[model samples]
Target: MTGRLYNSEQIRDIEQQAIAEMAQGDFVLMQQAASALLGLLKQRWPCRKRLLVYAGAGNNGGDGYLLAAYAQAEGYQVAVKCIGDHALLPKAAQMAKKATEQAEVPLLALSAAFKADVVVDALFGIGLNRPVSGDYASAIEQINQSSCPVLAVDVPSGLCADTGQVLGSAVKASVTLGFIGHKIGLFTADGPDHCGDLLLEPLSIPQRIFAAQEYSARQVNGAQLLAQLQPRCAHFHKGQAGHVVIVGGDFGMAGAPLLSAEAALRCGAGLVTVLTRKEHVPALIARRPECMVHGVEAQQDLHPFFLKASVIVAGPGLGQQFWGQQLLQQVLMQNKPVLLDADALNLLTQQTTPQLKQLILTPHPGEAARLLQCSSKEVQQNRFKAVQALHQQYQATVLLKGNGSLIAGEKDLQLLNAGNPGMASAGMGDLLSGIIAALWAQGLNAETATALGSWLHATAADHLAARFGQRGLLALDLLTEVRTLLNQPCSG
Candidate 1:
């Protein structure tokens, strides 16, 4: 599946829908799921004879009980520990208890044997919503303490499946088996820590079921979506591509505009031009002689230059002074496809400007916080909401930059798993802004340009890490990598 992402709530809905459509009883599905879990365990640990299953009072635990029975049937010594009393157990749990008893595996409490070759943690699934406390928390702690390998079902207990945040404390597993659709949380935030090497299974559900759901929460890399753009004709010309113009670069920040302009040129923009402070013009031209660099001390100087450009990337080193604001106001006045970054975003947020659909804003957490009139901590707490809020308020494609940078548009959203810690350094964002502008010039809308550019920038960084350690990777290092990526065969 391509670009399929789902939060905890959506996953629950899918599960319920699948259950409703099933002709068999819920117990049958639980048994099949449990058998699948045991099968995975056998494949993962073929040598392990002793098995431990942690079961709770819910359906998750019912799966655990059935797993124990399957393991026992497979000629392995199995032990089951139910977290709650029999009376408190859910209906599924009761059925599973009967099956387990029929198999002669007596259920015990938390005090059951802990010495096992592998531990199956089926105590909780995606229903977790609170902090781990009391006996459940203690049992989770013990599971982590165990030297044996642990496998988590659905999700690790104590993880917020919606946002990938820790509910308080969560189980650490060596592997996680995700049934049906994979939760979007598993690839972001604390999900990675809880869900180790993830495995997905559809449980034989028909493709029509997924089609009925209409979920678009997940996204793959840009190359997969843009495969048709590759393998340019041998006779392709520069004019057939697109032109990108970047306007920014106040007195001391010429490098910002230059970087953006160069990046746009590298990412298949046919012609690249830079409008910056007059003082930096000569240096920019000298550094990258291929670009048409212009010096603009006043906003009036930008008129003629702006007219000829297909896409405009505004604000890299733009300061928030009257001069910067004047330039920005003029840029906004022009109804062009625009990519805004750095001070441009800050200026827009400060002014509380009305939503503009033709613009894409790439803001770091701090910039996004300022735009939303909230604390950075609040945005970081739930990035999904922040991106959604940005899209709603500005009517623009919003790229919230940070760990697992999120891109949100009118009705779609995606998280980028590319990039590295080294990208936290200065000037990386400017480079990204440039790449997006270039893609915009190449006839992609804000969503496609922003998503593709963001992914390509990060992927290039990953490639850089392969050649040289990530320690000193610079934004300029991405230049060659992007060209190579654009020229390579696109593989889905």
Candidate 2:
């Protein structure tokens, strides 16, 4: 997850370097780009012949013009709707315009309606910084309103390449074709919703150009992270798998820790224990006899559990009552790998103690806002900045859950895009807490466990939703799927 996502500045620098250093001239690069788009477009919709392209005033427009020229040459009727004056176009785009003229592609007036099978959006690219207005806004809306499948060039116009924030009006593209480096906004925040069937074309940038540049963040790579847990050997026993302790489920909230414990066991933890209220112990133990349930009322009751636990997952249904606080304080002192989630995060905001060496903070947007002393809107405004601030402020790994879940540590930042809308249900975070804790108990480092666990949690949910619709997808449904994913072989 380290070098997969980049900011506008980084992508711009790489593009500039490519233009200056590579033997492939700027016009040749544009032609190669158009060729890549044509290949994908033909593969996706070979039967569709009518092509309508919205050309702007930049290199992005140049790409669209060239694509139109390529399609026209292939006998696909093509038309160009110029959103900007061709006189203002850059050198490469002007060259592309000349190419389009030579190809005899028709030019349509802006007032005309869309009649093509596919609409190509080349109006804006990574350089967009302000809210789209006037003709630009009109063009974006027209593209969105069209029933035809739209292909966005480079980026969906109006999206912030640096942060993924949408401008006044952004095209909801059926697909977005990116170039050079992956933009940060395309994977997080509003980017996931706007970008459909994402594809990246490196345009064959030389290896040295990329080798010299650094990235802003990375995609939460499943195969690399899954490698942390090798397929278990036949000789390995339950004792070698490690022990996980779930320390929440106060009074009426017994189900949270039970769900967590079940996930821990399902995800390969050798042993699972739930410490909860004395009244709820019988039912918790009855529902899942595999977990050893212990009821504790006093702080001293945590001693034996902490002594034997390889990792502690705290805060799932851990109410703000004295009973929960008493145990949390002692749990922190145990010096074992711990995950602070649910109500635990709410309580941690009041504490001044320095966090532990292996403590992980998993907070949804609202909870994250509480911990950061800011509004939830502010946290969502720029999630990377927020996660980084949380990691630096608490001096521990932080996982911010949302549309695109982010995992941040001292030197790592990973984003998970495998989840679905169905995950809006309850007990999801509790289940995630268990998965991470189980991995930690089984000997993965805190960062790996957090990143991989996030991936597993989301991917499992996605798998279930894909088979059975996203609605009403229970958190419990993921346990078996998680086991299946863990045992299956993964490809890079």
Candidate 3:
């Protein structure tokens, strides 16, 4: 009933179902979870023997206690930092603590300057909604400030499992092992930043339990999405690829639309046309001779070019001047696939609607905030909600760009799982708009184009960052890889 990511409620339901149908007790599940964590630790960090665990008051803490017991049994030096009172611990947690005590694992209460080869963060799990404070906050801070590598049992403590935001402060882990079904929180917003090398551990649950539940969203990595590209026939021609019209590049921002046009060309747009100011025409032609760069003085100049546009990509380098507004007005009137970005999104806020149906809106958080009449902070607090609201308001396929880019459409809600931090440069959105337009022109629908375009853009960025490093990466650095990726037979 679902995809790759599930909310906390859904994960709980799956756990309940597993416990009921699989005839597994809660204690058995905790034991299996702890065993899984220990196995992962041994496999990934065999040289490290000193283990420090933070045991909270929930079943999540119970997992930590059992892990300490299992590790102690295996002769690994282990210590537990008992955060909450043992009397307040859950039934399973009490049993786990008793077992750990039986195993002779030392339990202490110290909040700062802790040293361990590896830290196990089992303080909180998916149910925590309130912000961390007091002693819990101090422990998380110490964990973050420490030099030890952290293995978050299910999720990093202090992070909201549903919204993927920090409740107050979150433990930054070297690796996070998500149990049972993958949580939706682990793949969006700040989730990607806090979760290093995130992985899933099923804890030996039966597949039938998972197959019956529903998920919130899908984790769409570029590698998994690339299999959609089919081989072209020998008779296929440039004419069959479709025409993509780009409007923007007013005065000082000429580089924006040019980047978009180049991206479209590289992604196999049949015929590419750029409607920009006369000032950018020479540079546009000089940069990419194949693109038909027309110097438009008014909306009339855009009229001639719109006739051939299979798809229109607006807003790249589109300034908020009279020129950019005029171009946008003409674009909205056309009954074609339209993509809004950069200044075009900025301009969209000021204009009256023209029934832009076959449309796609690619907005970063700030632009999304402007469109939604909310703060960027609000939009980022729950990215899933913001993207859905954008789609509902604009009635367009919406892609919200950020740490883990999110796409909202009529069918699927996908989050990008392939991009790196290096893509946080100027002109990335412009390039993304172009790629989406090119794919739309080449025969995909607006929604598919937006989703695939997002994956392609991120995948290309990842390919470049893999070799050159992300510190000084440029937007244009992805063009070569984008072309190479489109031509090759990509395996999912």
What lDDT does the true structure give each of the candidates?
A: 0.81, 0.88, 0.87
Off by over 4 Å in 2: 1-3, 230-235, 489-492
Cα lDDT, model 2, residue 226: 81
Q: Write the per-residue lDDT of candidate 3 for residues 6-74, one digit (tens) a residue.
A: 899999988877777654467788998999999999999999999999988899999999999999999
lDDT of 2 at 402: 92
Candidate 1 lDDT score relative to the true structure:
0.81
The model with the greater lDDT, 1 or 2, is 2
Distance (Å) between predicted and true CA of 12, model 2?
A: 1.7
Off by over 4 Å in 3: 1-3, 111-115, 221-224, 490-492
Task: Sort the candidates on lDDT, descending order.
Answer: 2, 3, 1
Highest lDDT among the candidates is held by which one?
Answer: 2
lDDT of residue 404 for candidate 1: 76
Question: If ranked by TM-score, best first, what sequence of candidates would result?
Answer: 3, 2, 1
lDDT of 2 by residue, 184-226 (tens): 8888888988888888888868878887888888888887878
Clashing pairs for predicted structure model 3, backbone only: none
